[model samples]
Target chain A: MNKPASLVVLDLAILIDMYGDDSADTICPALSRFRSEASKYINQLQHAVVQQDHAEIARLTHSLKSMAGLIGACQLMEWSQLVEQAAKQRDQTMLANHLPELTTIWAALQTELASSLLLYGSADA
Target chain B: MTLTRNIHVLVVDDVILMCDFLYGVVNKVAGCRAIKALDGKAAAEYLGNERIDLLITDIEMKAPSGLELAQRVRSGMFSQTPYDIPIIIFSGNAYREVIEQSIAFDVNDFLVKPITSAGLTAKIQYHLQHKKVLKPMSHYAQLVADVDYAKAIELPTEDRAFSVAIVRELPEPKADDVDQREAASKAKEKKEKKEFLVWPEHATTGYFQLDRRMRNFAFNVSCFHNVFVENCKPVAIESERKRACEAADYLFHISKNIKQKDNRRDFWLLFQQRLDKLQPHVKELNSINIKHHSQVLVLLKRLAYWWMQTCSRPLIQINEVTHETADE
Candidate 1:
């Protein structure tokens, strides 16, 4: 039988360390909430980018950066920081260029986080 | 049998994930009860009504920034919690400006973000075990008021002296001009009202009554400095110096009135010694000649700087008291 795929984008170790060994109960629900919040922020970022509302873009990206950092999504956090800086500086071209890649990373992170939750959830059972 | 009380810590962040993560960490610690607030406004509500022993907050948020919340707490704006409750401000950046601002606002401690479980737990434990020495509310409030007055009276930097003199020398206005000026001044005052209080480190004495008196002294000294620099009449300069001397005398009287015991007694003794050193300068100010304006200014500046340093120094030395004793 083939082994399950390991998480690449999301670091579950940090959460495990924080919540301790039997953190499945804590981790699963927190990840689910994070996934939902990330989706809403992504939608808002897209709208802000389309409208070229730099302030809203900055604010959303900043929140996303902090949230991503909390869950050990380093790449997502870095991308969010870059996007936030661009938005703050009113660098329309940079934001337009980098936002798509940021979204791609978020999508990847969501999948990884979901799989990790499932793995931990089943193991706990 | 020994009794134990649950340590209630208030964790505030705008992000739900961050708040939950902090809550998890705090909940893991034995004898700790973690209460989470999603934003500063929520935190304020909790602080106003709940029994929060410690506050851990993020600096950046949607509104009422963590620093503002700290200011409100330190100023005794909340009804339930003690004004001097330990506040730990955490931020992703930990930049110089933020650190300086946190110190100015009198937060107990600061932490940078991406905190590990061990690091945060240790910080929470440390703050829980130790309480900070704080000025009485009356003193802190007066320091805030003095800083506000100082900021308001400060002249703009570009040709400040000339501009101030121009404004001061303006002839009496017509009745119509008076109404127009009053409208403009009111609008300016409204705009200048700050969202939060910032106590300058130099102005804080860490004692309620002493800080108030010392700030009054500084304000008078500042007035003297302004008039001296502007080459005002000798009479005006003398009047300002007299006011400053009167402030210094008040400081002396208030210092005697402070009733202290234990560690507070030690702080009071140190303040009295510093006051002894300061008295000579205040006396010198009274005798200094107006023609020797530079000498007078030097004395005023020295006393002001000395007063700030004395007040800013730590009053209570934290003993290595064990957590067990702290709980009792």
Candidate 2:
């Protein structure tokens, strides 16, 4: 299989180092938790965007920014910062355009994390 | 300097993982103990109970955020110590507004997240080490108030904890007519004020006329910082930069007063930050041309050299005093 592009996909090695190993004991559970909550974050972000609630957008993005930073999700963290800044400035167009990228990243992140967790689970078993 | 074998540091963050990471990083310091608080409320509780030697906190926690925590510590709202506890703000977002808030709230150091253990430890050590050398403004102010440079320069057998306590207590000089309106609007209401540097009646720095110049220089620089940082006015950039450079020259001329009279090194650390904080303000000078910015940067570089010499070369004077005393 072709190697995934370095920047776009998660670096499992870095994730393991940050979260403490790829096993169910470490990265798996954190990824699982992130996967479950990311959708809610995305949904709230979308709702906030639709309503043009700048404060809500800023609040949601700030949370995501911190979480993304913790998990070593550089791309998501950076995008969240941009959206957060835009929200702070009350730039509605900027918020609307970047709102969908949050879901796209969430979808990609969930798929990658789930596959990693499955591989780790089978290996452990 | 005598130090407690183990220093206690409190790390506050709302995220469990970030808290754990910071705790781990701080704990790695050989003689340091690290405590974790998952939110601002818990951090305050820890502050109330624990004898924390240092604080490293995130800005975006639950109520009473890290910025608020820093302000409380500075304002002595916590009632833990008369001296300000060293605070380092470790946040993921170093937004411009956050930096401004951190400065306004009196944070010692601001470090962004994803910090290395080495970087964090270095900042912790730097602040703590400086804290050991500083004395309350009352000590130095009293020495100056009495005009006793001889006693101020004495190399004590035992280490003293006081040096410059009322560094922040310096009063605003009477503003120019143009500045009167701007000053009132930008001024923060003072809760309590004290004289920081007082000269005794008929006090002279050997040279009679030079005394007035030195006093003006110090007051002008202090006023410049107060107006620039606290008042959030960058339009006064050109004049402020000129005053800083002029202050540097004045500091050079009366270098003796600073050398023999100023016992603590902590002011220089703050001075360094003040110099560094000039960058953002310099950037904010949108009205100024590129040439003006270039000139300001060059002048700042020169002023930094003068500032370092003023703070560091004084150690040589202290050594000379020690040697003279030894000879006697």
Candidate 3:
């Protein structure tokens, strides 16, 4: 089995290399912010989609995309980009279709990243 | 005065979460204290009373906006102290006009939001240590012009946008002409797509000077890839190990370069995170003495594609030309 072929969950090694023993100290707050902020935006996004508020949806997802990308949530970032573009273009159908997937992806990301953060925190401690 | 004691950062954002995030990020740096302002008016009020070493404000805030805050500080309208205060406009919008306006207002840097802690800290520290004296907007304009001009000069007249004349009349339609036009259109479309794959303008750090310093980095990655291919050594052999060692050297060189540029340390750190993801694959490829190392090659190729996509093909192509010209 090629170990290289698997998707990387978190590049904790790089973070540790960068921040040294302070890796968790730096990343934990950012990830914590991501958790709270992402949840708020996802709720806003869903409401915006229901109201067909394309501009508001675009604005909300744009921040979500940046935050997701910052935390190395690749799939979430990619999905946010699509939703942002669709919202910008006022494509209701596309936004409706992808919003659910984005929600699902965020759930998976939360679980995966929580464990990743724990690993870093424990290592640092 | 000690660096940390003197350094005061004002973090302005309409969203309380973002303000908290920036405050958290700033306090991480040694000798830095971050004060949060919820909107433009609050930030303006802070400027009136307190001495802020660095100002990081979001651009899209309502009523007296970040732009307004920047203008007020520059003009010394709010404060008694009259000097250039390092202000960084961190916003989600990369609208060209807004950027131009921000630069005109003498905003030190325009960092796109959703910025990592590292990227944000780098700009903050850089601006805090070395306050900008030059007109940032002009530097940005010239940077864009220089990039465009360099692209034009290096391309053939047929390929240059300046040489493309507007034709009002179509020659009498013919089958051969139709096929030729269609082929040209297809080729043009492909080129346009490639051109669009550049570093986002909104994410520009207001420092074009770093590009010159980083030129070597762009070359080193390319050179490592080329050397590996040219040698044509078997993957399981000693030569393969040598190549892995050489790749590691390039990685180390980049790490050192990032370290030396203290102001840009966080920015480079963000990029390093992405590079780190590719490292394990390289390590795996190096350790395994076997055939079917195609995955490693593919990963390297993908990394190269991402580098080009991020740094931009035009800049890389121009660097290649300069290198070739120098070699000659």
Superior by TM-score: candidate 1 or candidate 2: 1
Q: State the DockQ, from 0 to 1, for candidate 1.
A: 0.12
Error of 2 at B69 (Å): 0.9
Q: lDDT of all predictions, in order shown?
A: 0.64, 0.54, 0.56
Candidate 1 global CA lDDT score: 0.64
Deviation from native of the Cα of residue A20 in model 2, angstroms = 9.6
Clashing pairs in 1: none
Model 1 segments beyond 4 Å from truth?
A1-8, A18-22, A122-125, B1-3, B142-328
Task: Return the TM-score for candidate 1, rounded to 2 decimals.
Answer: 0.55
Please give, as one word, the docking class of candidate 3.
Answer: incorrect
What are the per-candidate TM-scores when only chain A is compared?
0.82, 0.78, 0.78
TM-scores vs. true structure, each candidate: 0.55, 0.49, 0.56
Ranking by lDDT: 1, 3, 2
| DockQ of all candidate complexes | 0.12, 0.05, 0.13
Q: lDDT, candidate 1, residue B140?
A: 57
Predicted structure 1: clash tally: 0
Please rank every candidate by DockQ, starting with the best: 3, 1, 2
* Cα lDDT tens digits for candidate 3, B258-302: 446554332443345445544665566456444445644554444
